[model samples]
Structures are given as structure tokens and as C-alpha cells.
Target chain A: MCRTGPSPDPPEGGETTSTDAAFTALLEDSADELYESAPCGYLSTLMDGTIAKINTTLLTWLGRSREEVVGRMRFTDLLTVGGKIYHDTHFAPLLSMQGSVSGIALDIKKAEGGRLPVLLSSVTKNDSTGRPQLIRTTVFDASDRRAYERELLRERQVAEAARTQAEEDRERLQEALAVLQQSLLPAALPPVPGMEAASHYHTASPDRLGGDFYDLFPLDGKRWAFFLGDVCGKGPQAAAVTSLTRYTLRAAALHDPDPVAALTTLNTVLHERYAAGDPRYCTAIFGVLEQAGDTVKVELASGGHPPALVMRQDGSAEYLPTPGGLLVGILPSAPFTATTTELAAGDTLLLYTDGLTEARIGEERELFGDVALRDFAADLTHTAPHEVIEAMTGLLNSFGDGLDDDTALLALGVPTDRPDTGSDSPT
Target chain B: MDIVSRNNVTVTGPQDAPVLLLAHGFGCDQNMWRLVAPALAENYRVIQFDYVGSGRSDLSAWDATRYATLDGYAQDVVEICEALDLREVSFVGHSVSSMVGVLAAAATPDRITSLIMIGPSPCYVDSPGYRGGFSAEDIDELLESLDSNYLGWSATMAPVIMGNPDRPELGEELTNSFCATDPAIARVFARATFLSDSRDDLKTVNVPTLVLECSQDVIAPREVGAYVHDVIPGSRLVTLDATGHCPQLSAPEATLAALTEFIGNQS
Candidate 1:
């Protein structure tokens, strides 16, 4: 164990004499010497901020002599103009109330032109009676820390600007997609003289373009041409196929007016246009409507598509099946099955894309197949064409997130014998 | 919105006495008048309020576009006067709020009858023949200083700075809430305070105005105070024997004496 008291006299030796001299030198380094040359600056001021005492370290940092600073200057006189305002407005008031303030950053002016960044702390020194007498302060150099903080602040500003720019670009792109989507469908369907007609289209996502399409336009004096179809795939490629199919059917119907002839012309056009490395196809129902007296005759042909449904005025609904039809745009010579139906007063015919039957429902992911849709139609057998389309639109909305594909619906019916109203006029 | 709660307004002293509307400057809130308000309340009814972005006011009402200029702050003063239904009031403002007083008085001439400015400067940056004691570069350096000090304002200090009026005990817990404000709001208020030039507006002041200046101040020098007195047609100037920019805190007795004497003469 080390001795705490005075050690016994050692024998005279060279090593012992050198150790004694080193100890004497360390003991001679007085408290006053340590204070004047300390690493950080130290200062003492009167309660009103008159500089009463300052160490050599702080005097040297200010680039001033002890005589010039000690009695003549105040603490605020050593700060920059901005630091003076901040001191008067914030620091001095806070110290007066809090008794001590720590980790406050400020800038002090030197005798020369430059400034020195510093971190300062001060505490009030009270007399024996517990009344405040003076203030003791300590300061440290913070040049490196301030520089690093400035770098971080700059980087954050740059990142914020980039994020705002990205948001603006995304909004502009979505607007352009919406305008292009509107051009792929008709604005309104023309009104048939002795019939009622309605249509609805649903899009699954705004980011991608939908492939389903439908339109109805007058073909001649007493006949109208209509078609509904869904192209394979989605986006711009499927949109191009849909556009080609619509125009081909409309032009072929005006020339011949046969439902099978219009589908044959569309199949030829789609097969030739997309026959290279990438193949495209579609499922379509093309039909023609002819008004004869108070009744209308409907003839439609299907190309690998679902059959059309006919709801009769006798409160019954059935499918007009067009079986054995081959997929359009696949084979050079494809067969399309033609089916005929008559719509009396209060009877409606509906055509829809497969997006309705293939929709996934509930947590079980079950398909709302063709059977449920037929039963749904049977309840509305005596309704008008617009009423049937409105009910189907409501059913589509009820699916919510379960329906993930684009859908199109088209309905046509002969008007009842009641007095004609101008509400159905094509204005 | 209830204007009384939105501005954290406090009314004190005799209700039948003449009104004294006190407005604080840029750095602090209405608490800047803490040292001198009690003495003034003995003679006059004192009305104190904080701007939307300062003190315990509703910070949610602060809009970046509306608070971008000095006119927005002037609108706040006008709204407070209208809310209280005050008439023939003496408007006392400090620092940048001195110029804000000029605007509010010009907007509602009948309501605000007189103006008293402490450490007021119509402009901060120097112009052709005028010396406002600062340059454009100096203002930029001040903004940097504000940014550096904001780094020291930690999360633990947020609750103390954002006072809770619901619990009166929490208000007592705040000892250092004088100059502590949200840094983002402080930046906007700082830019609006320092970058404005209201020298042209000073000529339009037709009220009984008093300009108070400190004997030795680094922020607003004696020359700027003299310029304000010269521009106004009939204005009285008083030089307080003080050292800093804020005379209310440094030399409260002299500030209150000069204020009481001028207000007494006005009546």
C-alpha cells in the first residue's frame, strides 16, 4: 500500500534526486498560473455586465490586452452587432430570470475583421446574504461544430426541393392520361327513334388505360349499329386494338348491315395489324337494330364472347346463345355464330364484357359467375333499358375493391305504348 | 374565431380609465412589458396581446402567405382594437412594432389616438443619405445567428415554451418563455421585421407621437431616432439614459416616467 504521510529520507542516489526535483517543479505550478493559461476562456463580470476580471486565454482570443478590456469594456461590447441584439433581447433577460444559462451559441468580435463562433455558459454568483453580486462565464470554440451543422441544414433543403418537384410531375402525368382515356370512348349515344338505349363503363385504375369499349351510332334511315368488346391485355397496346375494332365494325355495318359481316371485317383488320412478333386479340359482340312498326328486331354475332341476355315482357329472362364461335384475330378464317331476337314493348336486351362475371368477391375470392347475373336480371324483366343499366351500375359499385378489371354495359329496348315523352330526346 | 383567445389577450387595471394598448417587438412576446406594465396599470388600463406566431397565442391561425409582410402584423393590431371596441387609445409599441403602430394608427385613426415608440427605427438597412446603423449583409448574418441558436432549442424545452393555459400551474413552470418561440415562425417574423422600410409611412402619421431612444444602443442608433422625429410633422423625442436597445427592461423607471408624463400632457 502507498503511504499517505511524509515518506522517510531516501539514500542519496542519482534516480532519487531527479524524482525529487520533478515533484518540486509540479508543486510550484500555482493555481493562478493554471487559471490564466487554461484551455478555454474564462470571464467574470459585475451584475450590470461591466467586465471586472478576465483571464489571459479570453483576452488573447479577443486579440486585446488585459489593460484595454478589464475595466473599460462590458461583455456585450465584445459581441458582434447581431450578437448584441440577441444578447439584449434573449440572453440577458433569460440569465436575469433563470440564474444560469447553458449551451448557448453566440459569435464574438475580435480586434481584427473576422468573427469567432463560440458556445458560452454563465451563472450568477451571489453574496453571503443570498443576493446576486456578479456573473461567472465560460466559453469554448465551436468553429468545427457550426460548420458541420450548416452542411446538414443545406442537404435537408435540397431534399425538400426535390420531393416537391416529383409531386408536381406525377400530377401532370395523371391529367394527360385522363384526357387520352376520354378520347377512346363516345361522348353520348344517339337516340333510336322507336327505342330506348343506355350504356355505362367502369375503369379499375387511373394509372393504366382500360381496354373495354362500346358505342351506338345510326347506320341508315331506320337501322342502328352497336358493338361492345374487351381487348386482350391493357395499356396503350390494348387501346390501339380497341380503336381499330370499333372503326372496322362501324364502317362494315354501313356497307353491308349484316352482324356476321361486321365481325368478319374487324377480325381481318386486327389479325393483319398485330401479326408480327406480338399477337393481339379481342372478344366482341356486334349487332344491328332495325325498327319495324312498334317492335324492334335485334341480330347479333359473337366472336368467342359471352351470349347476350333477353328479358321479355312476360317477366322472364333467357340467354340467346351463340355457341361454337372462334376467338377473333387468331385464325385466318374464323366462324362467328349469329343469333336473332325480337324486343316487344317493355322488353330489354343487354350485352356486357366478361369483367362482370369474372369479378372476385368476398374473402373467399369466389367469382360472381353468369348464374348470379341471370338471376339478377330476372327481377328487372319488365323495366326499361335505362333502369336496367342504372341497376347494373349500382351492382358494379357494390363490388368495391373486389372488382379489379374494366367493364362495359350496353342495353337496348323498344318503347312502351304510352304517350312518348321528350325526356328521351337526343338533345 | 374568438379574437380574445386567438391572441391571448389580457386586460388589467381599472376598466373606466383611459386605455393603453401595449405591443411587444420581434424577439419576444407581450411579456416584454413585464417590468413596466404593473406601474403603467396603476394609472391606465393596460391591454396586452401576442401576435399569432408569438407567446401563447393560437399558432394554428398562422398562415405563411398572410404573415409574409409587415401589413399582416398591422392587421392583427387593427383586429384586436376592433374586437375590444376600444376608442381613443394610446398605442405603445417596441422595436419593429413601433412601425406597426404607425400602420395601425393610419388604418383606424379614430380608435388609436396617440403613438409612443421605444427604440424605433423606420428602416434597418441604410439608404442613400440615411444611416439606419445596419447593411443588407448584416441582416443576413443575423439570420444565420438565429439558425445556429435554433439548434440548441431541444425537444425537452418544447412543452415549456408552448405554454398550457388549461393548467395554470404549467404557466407558473415557465421561467424562460420570454424569447423562446417556434423556430420556423421566428424566421418568418424576423424577415418581416428587419427587411421592411417604413420611412415613407412615417410622414403620414398625424397622431400625437412620442419617439423614445436609448443613449447608447447598437440596434437602433440615435441618428435613426432623430430621422423619425424630423419626418413626422409634430413629434416629441425623448432620449432615455440607458445602455441597451430595450429601455423597459434596462431602465424601467425612466421609461415609465417619460410615458406617464407624455400621456398626462395629451389629456
Candidate 2:
């Protein structure tokens, strides 16, 4: 019984071995058949580059009888000119050192003078002594792949050009907004003697800036002319009319001393340029200052412009009113009005565009309208022009992503603290 | 110019006697002239050696770049004549090598008495209205076929080129001749041999020229050979009844008769 157990196990193992032998024989037969009929070419060469053997697939590709190429032709002879260079520079050296190389592209010269692109992979075969003797190479046709790659590159270039054009458009929009902002304000505010005056203008977005501007140049010593306004429409047409109005104001100022005459000249130019058809126009404020002593004389005009805010040294502020003024360019000889005020020490004035007052406050669609700005200005009555600008900048920042349109703010101030106690101190 | 290259060569021809130098084409080497050599040896000292990369010559010394042009082969012909100090030499080159003889003769008009051009062509391309027998494209196809079937067909076609080998394995050995030199070197020769257009040199040959046009030649047909004679200066066109390219093998008796008569007339 002891011997029977071991003997029975041997026969069982022997039966499994026979089954394995049959399975292996089937695999060998299939492999031989596959090699003879494979769709792609197969070849092997000596390390010295002589073609040692080849298959029917390659023979058919060459369109030659079997007796021709093998043993007589070297592998390099079959290459086209460009293919040969790639082979020498990249393929040959790589194959030699690595003893194998793969997916190498080549063009084999056909019997008819045309060339067929192909991908080749080769491995070095070694004898029992571990010395490489032959290279067995497999070739796959690659004509379709090359065509596809060329198409992809052409499409990519077209897409890159489109992206560049879109970027150029964005830059142009920002520049237009900047020019529109400049047209709303005077190029200069008439300078006041014995009074230190300064103002700041800040942009919200370069792509679409808030239209704001400020300037201080001499109308006369101790006297100045200044105004600020905002247009209703956006983009290039609005910018053209705004440019016309700003230059017209300067020209009319040189023609007459009256601020009202300057405002009328700007309105007439805007109407002629824009009011004919598809007219665009804006709201504006104009003012003239004349100083004799501690008190300075002032005249103001508004043409559908937001109210100008004034802050005094006594911690109180109010909006100077000149209502019922129409849009400056919509009608021929568009209606414009003026206002006057006396200047005091430690006084501040602010001008702004509707882009800021009309800004959305929250998801509720609530607007930070003119009243809210008036309240904000009142809070800054005791502050200087720079302090008011900084505070306004912080308020805009707190609005986060909600400021959808352009905003322009201009602020001007007269110093409360006297460094010299000069002519403005009743001396 | 026909190129002549040699480190050392043996030239055995008479000092003052009219020299007739013979060469073979394709499969066979210079030794193919052994049958007619003894006849010429009776009067003129004959010179013969293997081609640079063929037969018994040094294969290692072959410069692929130089020997790649038929000029190198033609140069050897010119040098052999000069080396032997032969004046008024008659160079009889067969098959592709005949063009080499024409070029060599054209280079040194004084040394070559005449060129016996067997088969020559200005170009292998077929003209719009004329057939040069094979179009240039056809020749290219033949070259590609040669590349693909170089091993098997060269062996199979050897006896046809060399006629009868003393041993059966001789055909096999000649088929493997492509491997005798580096396969790359053989490639250069194959291109230089078949692609040559030597018709331009024919008219420049100042010597009295004779082109032997072989009838029924598959390699160099009779009509094409006549075209060669037409281009050459004062050349006599003779068409012999022969079957193949190597008339020396296919019609040696007829070939011998022709050579002797042509040379004897001058003598």
C-alpha cells in the first residue's frame, strides 16, 4: 500500500506532462503559421549591416523576387536620403550601445522610386557566448501617422493666432476707457495763489477703467477753472465725443473768461459731432475760481452731472446743487447751467462718475447710489484730499467682485494747516 | 576622365608591337581571355590582372569612393597601357567596360591606336520618339530586382554569364561575389556600372574606333550597339552572330576571328 501511493502519483504527473506537451506543440505550429503570414515586414541583419534574411512581407514591399536582396544588399541601401541621415545620426549609435532600439522611423525606397515610411524596432541577438551577432527588426507602416501629425500642427498654429487677437482686443478696450476718463475732466484747474492745492485720480480697472481725471494749471494766480463729468454710453463712440468736448472746453476758455460760455461751446461741439444721428453724450460740471484775499470767488455749472461734494474744516459736508441740466451732446445747443461758491481754508471737493454711485451693493441688486456717496463724503469732512481718496479706494475694495462697470474719481483739497501763515490768513 | 589606379601591376606586351588589351564584363574576370591570350601571346606580350575588387587582386585596397565611378576602371585600362609602355595600343573592352575603354582612349589620344567598343550608349533613357531598348526607369527596376534577388538570381544566372564553370559550385561562388568586397562597395560598383552614359566620350575618341555589335544580346542589343558605332568617330560597326553579352564566351571562335582580322589588317 505504501509503494502504491507513490506509484499512482507518478502516473498522474505523467498524464499532465503529456497534456503540456500537446499544448506546446499546438503553440509552435500556430507561431510558424503566423510568421509566414504576418501583415508587416520582418528582417534581420548582421551587426556589420548586411541583410542576412527577410520575410515575404518585405519582399512583396520591395516588389522583387526572393533571390535578389538577401545576402547581397545591405540594410542601408534600402533607405531614402532623409531616412539614411536619421539612421546614421540617431538610430545606428543608439542601437549599437543599447543592443536594441525601438519605434525608429525610416523611409524604405520602393522598387518604383517612391518611398514608404515605416516604424522599425530591433533587438540584438547574441550567441551563447553573449556576443551580439545579428539584429532582428520588425517594421510597421507609418504613412497615416505622419499625415495626422502634420494636420495637428497646422490647426494648432491657427488657434494660437486667434488667442493673440483676443488678447489685443482686451488691451484696446482698456486704452479706450482711459481716454474717455480723461475727456470728462479739465486738463487743468486754474491755480490759486496763497493756497496749496492738490488732487488725486485713481483707476479701478485697466480693461474698463472708471472714467476719472483731475488737473491743476494756471487760469490766473489765485484763480482757476475746473470741471468733471461722466458719459452714459461705453466704448469707442463715447470716447470720440468725450475727446471733442474736452478740447472744445479748453478752446472756449481761451475765448472768454465766463465758465458758462466755455460750457456752451463744449455743448455745441458735442451736439454737432454726435447729435446728428446715433448720438452719444454725457453729464458734466464746470466751475471758475477768482481769488482776491482769504475768500476766493467760485462759479459752477452742471450738465446732467452728479453733484460736487464739499467738506469743511468744521467736520461738516454738503453737495453743491445745480439741478435741471440736460445731457451735453444729445440736442443742438444742449442746455447747461453754472453755480458759484466762496473758498475757505481747509476745504475739500470731490467729483465722480455714475459707475461708482450705480455700483451694485450685494446679491440683492441694491445700488450704492448718490446718497450713499454723499454720506461717505460727509464721514470724511475732517480729512485731506489724499485721505478721502484712500478711504474711497478701501470702500471700492470691500465691494469685491461686484463692481461690474468702469469707475472714475477725482478729489481736490485746500490745506487746513498753514506752513507760512501767508496772504490767506488775513495778513 | 577614365581613371587609372594601381599600386603594382604586371603588363606583358611587346615593346613596339601593336598592343591589344582585352577585358571581360560582369561575372567573369580578366582571366576569361585565357583562350585567346595564347594566340595573342605568340606575337604580343599581353597584360591581364583581376579588377580591383574582383578575382585575385587585393580587395582591401579598393577605394570605394574612387572605384565607385567607371572612371576608376577606365583609368586602370589607361595605366595598364602606359605601365606596359605600349604605343598604338588597341583596347578591346566588353560590356560595360567597353565604355571605360572609350573614355580612356579619349583621354590620351596618342597612346590608344583605336577603341574596339563592344556595346555603348550615350544614355539609357528612352527618348520621346525613340526606344533605346530599355527606359531608364526599367534599368532602375532591374537594379531594384538585383537588390532583392541579388543572392539567388546571381547564382542562378552565373552560368549564363560565365557559360560553363569547370565546377558546379563555381556559379555559387560568383553569386557570392557581391559579398567578396564589403556589400557597400559592391553597391557603389553596381551604380557606377549600370548607370554610366558613355556616349558623349565616343565622338571625342580621336583614334579609329570599331564597335562590335552582338546580335541577339539580351544585355546589349544590336540596335543599341549600332547607335554606339554611329556616335563614335570613324568607327566601324560590326555585328557578329552571338547570343549573349559575353561574345568571347558565346562565340569565342567568331570573336577570335574578328579580333585577328581587325588587327591583322593594320599589320
TM-score of chain B, per candidate?
0.95, 0.78
Stretches of model 1 off by over 4 angstroms after superposition = A1-35, A45-49, A88-100, A123-135, A182-270, A278-365, A368-400, A403-427, B1-22, B36-50, B55-61, B79-90, B151-184, B252-267
Query: Model 2: runs farther than 4 Å from truth?
Result: A1-37, A46-50, A63-77, A84-104, A123-135, A157-217, A294-296, A332-337, A418-427, B1-267
lDDT string, candidate 1, B177-258, tens digits: 6666777787888888888999999989999999999988778899999999999888999999887778887678899999
Q: Count the backbone clashes (under 3 Å) in each candidate.
A: 0, 22
For residues B59-97, could you state the per-residue lDDT of candidate 2 as single tens digits?
Answer: 546787778788888777677766656678788776677
- Candidate 2 lDDT tens digits, A1-427: 0222333335456677677557657766676576655888889897656788888888788776667888877786787633443353235444544566666556688887787777788888999998777889998877897566556655866887899898898778667665666665554444456454444444445554343433444565455766677666655555556566666666677677486777777777877776557876777787776764666667878888888888776666788887878877777776666777765766777777676787788789789987888777778865667788788878777777667665656666666665344443311
What are the TM-scores, per candidate, against the unseen true structure? 0.77, 0.50
- Give the 10-residue window scoring lowest on summed lDDT in candidate 2 chain B: B1-10
Q: Which candidate is the best by DockQ?
A: 1
Q: Write the per-residue lDDT of candidate 1 for residues A1-427, one digit (tens) a residue.
A: 2224665776387888777767767776778987898888999998667899999998889999999998789998888877777776677666765677776788888998688889889999999998768889998888898788779878867887898898888889888878877777888888789899999999999888899988899987988988898898999888888878778887888888898888888888888888874888899899988887778888889999888889887778888899988788987779999988888998899999998989888889899988988998988777789999999999999889888999999999876775244343321
By summed lDDT, the worst window of 10 consecutive residues in model 1 chain A runs over: A418-427
> Model 2 chain A, poorest ten-residue lDDT window?
A1-10
